[model samples]
Target: MDSIPSGEGLIARMIEGDESAFTSIYRQYHPALYTYLLRICKIPSLAEDLVHDVFLKVWEIRHRINPALPFTGYLYRIARNHAFKTLKKLAYDEVLQEKVLEHLQFQGNGPEQMVNEKEYNRLFQEALGRLTPQRLHVFRLCRQEGKSYDEAAAILGISRNAVKKHMVLSMRAIHNYIYRQGLVITLLYLAQKIF
Candidate 1:
């Protein structure tokens, strides 16, 4: 389905308890939700589980859907809430957290294969953490999460110019750190060769 759906047909169909229609809704929106969950959580398995949970909640509450509102919005609202909850849960479990970190580790042809993704993830998180919440929010909303400046600004309740400013700072900080550590150069060189 197109990301911009046509009004509330989905909500109406879902509310009417049309099982196949609900399945269509799920199939149409699953990819976007999965991508959002994966980027935010940085763990594919957890992200997949959360995506399942999001759809399950939508199905479980089918009768409660309001036809006047778009079901896509409702679905994403559930996804976002569930993702945040999962993030918090992951923060509390050292073993599970380590597993997620280990799972994200990168491989290379030789010695580079040994790189610990945990260190990179930790550094990225630390750099992000050092920002004020507003700046970090701007950073994630614009860059990592790929929302447009206008969208991010609206979500942050700020002006587009401010969003640009914070994102500039955030990107500069990230790029500088990555470059100082040789990661940026390596990524850039590889990207130029690959694509």
Candidate 2:
């Protein structure tokens, strides 16, 4: 089974300039963080690039991210800020995806590629949107933003157990949807990554 080192230890190591720890952190948080960015930036490639950029910033400002503080919140704050800035500079429309992608140093696929990724993203975001608002909020806090259950619970005014339940329900719903569509192999790989 795959495992993530404990958050505090990882944060301490990262604070001490351990690249391995930061890499582990980047891998651990990549999926949810990327999805969150995709929802904002509305493009897979841009989201992926933003994830890399966010980590680069994190590594550069490692001293500011206190090991004693929750790194998850810090990470999400950076992502949200970067994504918002990107959205504003690009003027917040389909016309802007390519421009933002270019500024982010990615391929400039005019409209067709953008359309396809946006279509898939629409379905994916819709799936996430189907959850109860509280559940969706918790899922975003815990999975999408990499917050610990307790931390998320505190942020959302819920118990830790509720946080765990929302996460399980979100995963179960997504994997079941994927399975019904006969995407078991792809779902299995995603499962391997997140779990």
Candidate 3:
């Protein structure tokens, strides 16, 4: 019967780039880490991916692992950080997809409007580009992304009132920009309807 190495020995072996030591660590910790991530992320595939990412990071930073500290605690911290980052990216992707869909729908229901829609889209992009990065992010998160004020606030690390204020100001600026473009009243109506 073979005994598993102590945490200290395993850490040293991993720092030396021992594949078997890394495998041993993975086999010991992967299940618990997967379960913890699954509980936090609530998506099986995402949880599995995060667990894999955590282990990959651990392997990459193996030399930095401190054997004197609680290895399990360190592993969990890595898993937690990976899960949060993955979640944030997923949320951002979802929001971007929604914005694209909204833009498509706003274009029109018929092919006859294609040329006008293309020009309008160009101008709209320009308007968006004119916004300060922070205001643009806030607007996208709160308006185009359809996130609630609280959700935007939490994600942006700002107060709920601040999110509301940014949304108000952002919408006003976009409205004024479109109005100045002399596009049409329908464009203004569409903008108001969408945001």
Candidate 4:
């Protein structure tokens, strides 16, 4: 079995500019974070780039990280925020969006890819369905419709901070739902293979 390192210890060391601690954190979190970002961006190269970008940002702000708090959530928040910033830019840039679309279209996906896409879409929808009605509405407005937080707030007659809070909660809920579902699927596959 692989041993899990002490996150707080590693983080504390990283705060002291320990390269090995930072590398350990990167090794521990990279795969899952990359998968998560890939799902969000739908581009492998961009997701890989975003992963590096996130790690670099983490290293830059290591001193500010709270070693007492769970590092996974903090790391994920950074990754999510970075990915969303890139996506927000993509949403505003028609040329970039067209290029991304063209790139995706150029990639010839096989049947396996199709099945994976369907599974991902199903899990994503299920996660969305698990959100509260208000949270769901806020998510649709800001994420799906590409509305700004302020615009979403105006539409819902709520404060912008409330809209932002809803969006953050909704995203956390969605990520947790998908992660749970993924674990279940993985376990089921393992069981089938074993039995």
Best by lDDT: 4
- Tell me the deviation in Å of residue 112 in model 3: 35
Decreasing lDDT order of the candidates? 4, 3, 2, 1
lDDT of 3 by residue, 1-195 (tens): 866596888878887899888999999898988888776654466678778889999999988988788899899888776665554454336553343234435654322243366766776787889989988999998778899999999999999999899888888887656534523333333333322
Q: Compute the lDDT for candidate 3.
A: 0.71
Clashes of each: 0, 0, 0, 0
Error of 2 at 75 (Å): 0.7
Cα error, residue 154 of model 2, in Å, equals 75
What C-alpha lDDT does candidate 2 achieve relative to the native structure?
0.69
TM-score of 4: 0.50
- Full-model lDDT for every candidate: 0.68, 0.69, 0.71, 0.78
Cα misplacement distance, residue 17 of candidate 2 (Å): 0.6
TM-score of each: 0.48, 0.47, 0.48, 0.50
Writing each residue's lDDT as its tens digit, candidate 1 over 38-99 gives 76665678778888999889889888888787666777778877766555555455665554
Clashing pairs in 1: none
Better of 2 and 4 by lDDT: 4
Off by over 4 Å in 3: 1-4, 95-195
Poorly placed runs, candidate 2 (over 4 Å): 1-4, 92-195
